[model samples]
Target: MARGAASERDGSLSDGVRPGEEPADAAPPALAIEGLSKRFGDGAASVLAVDDVGLTVERGSIVGLLGPNGAGKTTLIKCTLGIVLPDSGSVRVFGADVTDGRRAAYANVDAMLEGARNDYWRLTVRENLRYFATIAGVDPDSVRGRHDRLLDRLELTAKADTPVRELSRGMKQKVSLASVLAGGAELVFLDEPTLGLDVESSRTLRRELRRLAREEGLTIVLSSHDMDVVEDVCDRVVMMANGRIVADDTVAALRSGAGDVVRVVSADVDDAVVATLRERFDVRGVETDLGAVERDGDRRDGGDRRGPTAVEVAAGGDALYDLMDALRAAGVTVEGIETVRPELEDVFVDLTGVEPGEGGSDEGGSGEGDLSDAAADSRGRSP
Candidate 1:
């Protein structure tokens, strides 16, 4: 309630959801940030880590924050949690200024932030949970009632007596997460939560996340570079570049919305004709997945006369007709053409104006940044 008191009052803020659709008597937003900007250093030496970014998470939803490395995601999260102060911007949790850093806000929001620290290496897993519960102000009797439940769910019950130093890296990560929830939080932030996890542990966490979101109505903010995890877990995603939101929508919409991959399958045809057809097209990308002897099992004698080739095309836009005409003029025969939806990776690549695996922040970030040195120091050890 301290910094974001005016966010709701602005009346111009965008929720993306249609009007009158907000839940009746809904519990206040789990988190909100407006006109958020953060910078590091000063003058020419300064860099903007977050730039006028604003977003709101409704009462219960799984939201994903994604971007290339150094895209300001970590900075935004740190500021929102009041671990670091934004040079200019306001943060609110449940309609209260998060800047106040109230005990309620801290209790209501538990994050397995980047570089999340685990329990003391000398203590057992159970001991670690108890220690964190005490720090979060949880009553011993209350924690005792639910202790076994969480341990079992995380598959840590067997290691309850094992010292933290002896636990596997993934097990410790799970424990760090469990400790955050032991105090009871309505909203949770998981930054690269599955980074060090194996296939099975990752699956377990995914199931747990879905359960919490659907059954417990917990609002979750997840940040990760794992495309599969984000695609499967988030209800919606917000992508950032150069500290600004470049795209915000559902995974399905983003994928199908980008474009289609069209594949054309044809029978025996001339080599020169197919070459002419391909040369005339302005496709985004094209590839030939032809088999050893082509689809008709006709082996090319390595001569100039080539058989028909399937032209798999992408970017269903202009210049298609030109290719068709060229092929016809060159005496090429067409068999069939098909189209398929793009994948989530394709959508992200298109929206961010970057190719897969080569994406970078639209703009460099680094001015007036917030986040405590301690938290950041801890995040360095997350993976």
Candidate 2:
């Protein structure tokens, strides 16, 4: 078995999912956010970025913070990390009041927010790690030992002597991440750590992040716009849109949202046939979209009636046999069960309607909503 996983090479390994096959019931919370709200500028034109949102992240568990562009995810994260002060809210990192304690509380916390804070352009990757570890008050000698191992694992051993300015974006990202681990932080915060990495590098980073969190018993809070990243990495997910938690549940629980999408891949699927599906399932989701595709429709889209599709309802733990039975009874052709599964992309698109940007910046764009979900899902809320 892989560390923090049900199986080796399981998608869950890189995805950060722990389905708890134990057959037991209930678990403890690791990190909790309570009634957290952060508003920028006050009064009349105050922009409410993180409004009364909360959720819990468990020890030795991976959780994802998801939302669309301008959803105030960054603001909330900033507030949690003490980078931004909240108007009214509280964030607990490893059970510490993050907004109140400041540096002392952050001593046990290590983060690579926006993946940009880890580098020293003049220093080598190894040098950077040494410097950060030293500053974090970790033993100097321990830095050397850990540096070698991190360089090897991150495939940066060859680049140990390379200047940060010379490395590629992905390489820099790896180095930055290594610095976080080097600090020996008990809790890790990574916001889009793999944003620009290539596929292989991204996969390795994901795999390693999973291993680090589980095997080392590190608590992690990860924010990402990639549904695959979130779907694969989180044990549970907390979604924020228009500055609030809209959906909070296990990935398995969220997949239940996609309990309806059925991918057909046997022969040709013509327009008429597609049209036939439209009449039955909410076919509006099938249109060409620039965003990631989920099993049924959008989970992050945040639009009422985002689109309906049999694929989504098909997900919520429903058996494919039942679906085939329904399809056949509906007079729809059964092309061969290519695969019956839920799509996280559909789940994300459904709720926020847009991909989450690095920060709630205007460049990535924001969602359209008159949200009343101002302060939902705070960890304080009773389950």
Candidate 3:
């Protein structure tokens, strides 16, 4: 919504035309990087944080940047934001090359990294918004209405005059996002934007982000460990591993490509049954319905009243039939069976060999260009 005034001032919105209405000579992508490579150190100790990566983000789209720690995600983001210089690559923002000048390239960009630390804790919420807007080369008075709307939407109007240090973590996180938007940035990067938010606040922020992208032609590159948020909000997901882009596609496409799993719920399933199934099929997990077992008085101390066990097996295509045969041979009575579509989290784990929310080494090479670097970068220019 803030971009309306910004477009008039700088023509950042597709060179004065609205989104999807660009002329034959349309503007370049909101952000683009080619042959991007970055490494820290040298010799045997060197770490290739980004390995010849290339990426493009279109305007008015929400793309999820997903990867586990040490997957080069943080390094890639820092390089894109100009916080970390790439060893070899070219970064272009809104048709302007970052090498030529970041002031022009990232003029309409902003970011929130490391949660609420991006904001000035001593400043009031409104003051922080105005301060960031001024630094972004926009008159705070010109976008006061936009700031008000952001505060209202994020439920921070009541705390507008309150010092950011006095607010709760979630509220301060909201302030950080509001400050990023206050400058009418057309492209934004948000890392863990909903890190400390409650359910209601998180939903509110997601709704607003979607509206901003759809209505204001804002482009977002979001990085988060929250798979549910990424699945719900992102139009496309780009996953990285070992400094390489392993998968990039829509959330639905990624899930579909991950192959379907079969879940069998059986009251007779036990360790022996699970082992047998594992021998025949790839058993993903075996979860016992503890509540159901308690209700049936099937505690271990009681009798052999085993409760229902849900066995998640990778039994797609012909494997399903063979799995059924195995179950029949085992004399197991299936209570229910259904095809389980892989979630984004499942796809992520399959591709990266890392569990969701798992943390690893600092991808920026010995923790270089981390949150502290991001904070310092955000203060000087568009993050």
Q: Each prediction's Cα lDDT score? A: 0.67, 0.62, 0.82
Question: What local lDDT does model 3 show for residue 106?
Answer: 74
TM-score of each: 0.78, 0.71, 0.89
Q: Write the residue-wise lDDT of candidate 2 on 157-250 in tens digits.
A: 9999999889998898898789777756667778788978999998888888787776666678888777788877778888777887888888
Q: Clash totals for all models, in order?
A: 24, 46, 0
**Residues 1-383 of candidate 1: C-alpha lDDT, one tens digit per residue:** 01111111111113333333554455567788899998877789666879999999876689999876557777888777766678898888878786665554555666675543545677888886776566555564566656677788888899989998898889888887777666556677887888789999999988888876765567899988788999989999998877889888999988877766666654444455455555655355433434433435555442444333566555366545655565577665665566777777767776666543354332243221223234534322222
Model 2 / residue 6 / CA error / Å: 33
Model 3 Cα lDDT, one tens digit per residue, 228-276:
8999899999999989999999999999998779988777788899999
TM-score of candidate 3 on Cα atoms, chains taken together: 0.89
lDDT of 1: 0.67
Candidate order (TM-score)? 3, 1, 2
User: In candidate 2, residue 189 scores what lDDT?
Assistant: 76
